[model samples]
Target: MEREHFSRQFDAELNDIREKLLEMGGKVELMIANALLALVERNTELAVQTIAFDHEINRLEMEIDEKCLEVLARRQPAARDLRFITLALKIVTDLERIGDQCANIAKRVKELNLEPALKPYIDLPRMAQAASTMVKEALDAFVRGDENLAIKVCQDDQVVDDLNEQIQRELLTFMMSDPSAITRAMRINYISKCLERIADHATNVAEMVIFMVKGKDIRHTIA
Candidate 1:
């Protein structure tokens, strides 16, 4: 009976951790969407909204960290549970960083209003959406303990990287063609950099999922 009680408590704690992770992921997704909308629509209001979300993301991250520490001290989980908690800690860091990047992009969007948009914002938003989807699906895979889905998320990161590079080249061409576009083009360049960072965060989440499943680090290891 005592063993069963401890088991139940451990499961409950893990469920709580997953819930917080999902909350963080959802907020990151909103940040990305709002930031992109701010860019495409030139809406300062939406940009401000994305900036606000960064605070909430940071708060949730702290709450999750506290809960993880409590579980570690009280439950003393081992093996798979230990791995899950460790990975959750790392995942939250990546999620929080992604939120900051979204805010940075939104800030850039707000400033771009003074100058006409260099282009219709074709590739950047698409790449942000794809990165957001990868994050959502990767977290879903973690929730379900579905290693196959996690693998899919890892594969999707390559697509995001390709899109990011495409955006860079296209923006460079614009700056080269029109000397007047240099300033706005540089702003767009930073936005693309933020998107690339988001893709990197998504890849970090994928790496955590792999560690959770296979009990391997595999972080710097090339697949």
Candidate 2:
């Protein structure tokens, strides 16, 4: 009876970790969306709000890390359970870093807001959307234990990479042609790089999900 009770309690603890992780993931996704929207609309207020929310993400990372540690100490989980706990730790770090990238983009949005419009902003929003979706799908893959969904996330990362490259090339042309546009173009380039980094972090999470579910480490290998 005691062992059974302990088993249920341990399961509940694991569930708690998962719940917290999902919460953090959701916040990071919103931060990315809000930051990009602020950039497109030149809404400095929304950018400020998004930057402020990153503090919450940082707090959640610490909270989840502590919870994982407690579970490790008390439950002494092994095998799949062990993998889940460790991956939870890893995922939160990735999520937190994603939040940091969002904050960086938000800061760039503020700077760009001061300058005149730079082009039509045609490809930047699309790239941000793709990156945001990758983040959402990666978290979904984690919760569903869907290896295929995780693999798809990995595959989709290249789309974002390509968009980023395209944006950089266009911005380079602007800088090459109009010397005065250098300031605004460079800021836009930084924002594009931030969005690209966010996608990279999402890919990291997806790779970790593959490890958690299949016990296979596919980090350095092509997915």
Query: Which candidate's lDDT is highest?
Result: 2
Candidate 2 on 31-133: residue-level lDDT in tens? Answer: 9989999998999999999999999999999999999999999899999999989988989999999999999999999999998897777798999999999
* Number of backbone collisions per candidate: 0, 0
lDDT, model 1: 0.87
**Model 1 — which ten-residue stretch has the worst lDDT?**
214-223
Q: Each model's TM-score, in the order given?
A: 0.96, 0.98
Report the Cα RMSD per candidate: 1.2, 0.9
What C-alpha lDDT does candidate 2 achieve relative to the native structure? 0.93
Q: What is candidate 1's lDDT per residue for 18-111, written digit by digit as tens? A: 9999989998998899999988999999898889879999999899999999999998889998988988888888889999999999888888
- List lDDT for all candidates, in order: 0.87, 0.93
